[model samples]
Target chain A: MSTERGLFDLTCADFGLIRGITESWDHLLSRSIAAVREQFIEQCGLIAQAEALPRIAGRILGLMVFDGKDYSFSEIAEELQISRGSVSSSVSLLTAMGVIERTAKPGDRQDYFRLSEDPYTTFFARARNRAERAHKTIQETRDAVPKDKREIRSRLKEYETFYATLIKALDSGT
Target chain B: MSTERGLFDLTCADFGLIRGITESWDHLLSRSIAAVREQFIEQCGLIAQAEALPRIAGRILGLMVFDGKDYSFSEIAEELQISRGSVSSSVSLLTAMGVIERTAKPGDRQDYFRLSEDPYTTFFARARNRAERAHKTIQETRDAVPKDKREIRSRLKEYETFYATLIKALDSGT
Candidate 1:
């Protein structure tokens, strides 16, 4: 009976050690994951700001794009540390921009949002269109100016040419 | 004698009319040119803000790129309607970023600023490097996470793949 008691004690000690190891592993893993998510959100903010999108909207879209998963409105707001109302409006705006879309989960009343199939392609296409229009506007202005305003006319021509080159570059693709 | 005087008066009146038309044309041309410059500056501000650049610096760079000429510090300040101190710091920052360079004109004491030889190419190259670093960081995190966390690991993998595709796309030119 004494020998049996010793075996039982050893078994309990080993199990507790294993549990401790697992718990520590989980803690470290969660910390690292949080860091990655934070970094990703920041990157998305930078790109979105560059593209002239609002910060919160960019963050929501960024989270969806990187995670590639559908999120409920509350989930996104909580994850991003933003107000629920802000998330609601930003998601709506992103949906309208074709950067993200809403889907309903079966048997669940909460709406879910996910990135569009090809957000970057759509964004770049819009940028190309804007450049083309700017080029046309510059061309018209150049034509309207008199010949003697050589310096100003030359500047407009350069802009027209640069935009033309840029559009051509964009069209060629990678 | 009377006929000669009348003819002279008619000639003078015609000459004055021609001068007035020329001056009016010049006035309209300058105003339109100013408008174009203002619009271009505004566009640059938008793109710069999107890219996390200082707005004034972006405007100055945009002016140089479109005009394809060097400008003195005062000229840039005056043209953009910004303070000289802002222009000074913005130009310095842009020069450090490799988007613009300082040039000296023969016989002119003041420094001039102009766009770098290929600003867009340089800018895209920097962007590619940043993407590569992000991919590596994500890869490390993905490896560190436990296999049971399939959702988190999968998100990191997707990000890795997307950045790889983006760098490839950026590398393919323009």
Candidate 2:
């Protein structure tokens, strides 16, 4: 009977801790949101860098994707603590790439930016195009090389095959 | 008959152009390979930057992936035009991360480095681990917040769902 009472007290203490954490969750996140935001920025920065663009473009995309809401240029700049000019250029680049879309509010001249419905699909589509181009380049190089150079022929053929397979996989969406 | 002759002439011209290009393909790539190499380096550099690692590590991996062959430290330095020390440090980091592997020649003391057979698989595996960690963080944050704040609750829930779905996708390898 004493052991059962002790166990009940422990369970109640655990519940109290849970209740305290649940009540203050927002306060905790608000205090630590900077770290989370930085991590997302880094993730997007990587994607942007791989695509051979400025980090700012990735940061803007990351912000838009995470917020899951549209933001005007001024709003984005203010939220991200960046300059309006930087936001303008990055937003323009992302718009041209079709990674983000531009919309406007009724009776408002401000342009708002948001991520596309399926950004990953669009992202991989661009990658597939790049792979296709590289594959074509390798094929051309293979054709141009002398038939006698078997080693070079074999190496180029391998590259050609890799790119071909990459494009096929991307096209298949698997 | 005249139209047939004109078509034949056009085909012959095209073949002639192909022959010329074929003969010069090796020469062309040799000159342009630098640009191509830089592109790979840039791509890898982005990945490294996002991961908060040195750019050299990505450059080494990029070179190995593109070359599709094992290379000695000196050869890597020579090909990528980086310092020997940079190669040593970056190669170590990549090796530790399992992104690159170290091999050896039977009669040679020098260590050779090459990319893993399926680098993308391995790369995404690491990313999935990071995502799982982030998901846990988000879950904890959500648990700590008050339930009465609908806007904050919805936003946190959205982020939690995104990370949860991401981890699941990565786990399923689809």
In the range A1-174, model 1's lDDT, one tens digit per residue, is 354654346676788998899888765665566666677677767656655678888788668855778899889988989998898889998888787888999999998988777655555566577767767766766776668878768766765776676666556553
Error in Å for residue B110 of model 2 = 3.0
Best of the candidates, TM-score: 1
lDDT of 1 by residue, B81-102 (tens): 9898998899998888888899
Grade the docking of candidate 2: incorrect
**Once superposed on the true structure, which residue ranges of model 1 sit more than 4 Å away at CA?**
A1-47, A62-69, A106-108, A126-141, A144-158, A168-174, B1-34, B65-69, B106-108, B126-141, B147-155
The C-alpha stretches of model 2 lying farther than 4 A from their native spots are A1-55, A58-70, A114-116, A133-166, A172-174, B1-71, B78-81, B93-100, B105-108, B113-174
Q: Listing every candidate in turn, what is its Cα RMSD in Å to the true structure after a full C-alpha superposition?
A: 9.9, 10.0
Give one digit per residue, the lDDT tens place, for model 2 in B1-174.
354654346676788998889768745655355555566456666556655568888677667755668899899989878899998889888887777889998999999988765554554466467657656655665565456646545655665665565555455542
lDDT (tens digit, per residue) of candidate 2 on A34-93: 555566666666656755578888778767755668888899888878898999888888
Q: For model 1, what is the alpha-carbon lDDT of residue B86?
A: 98
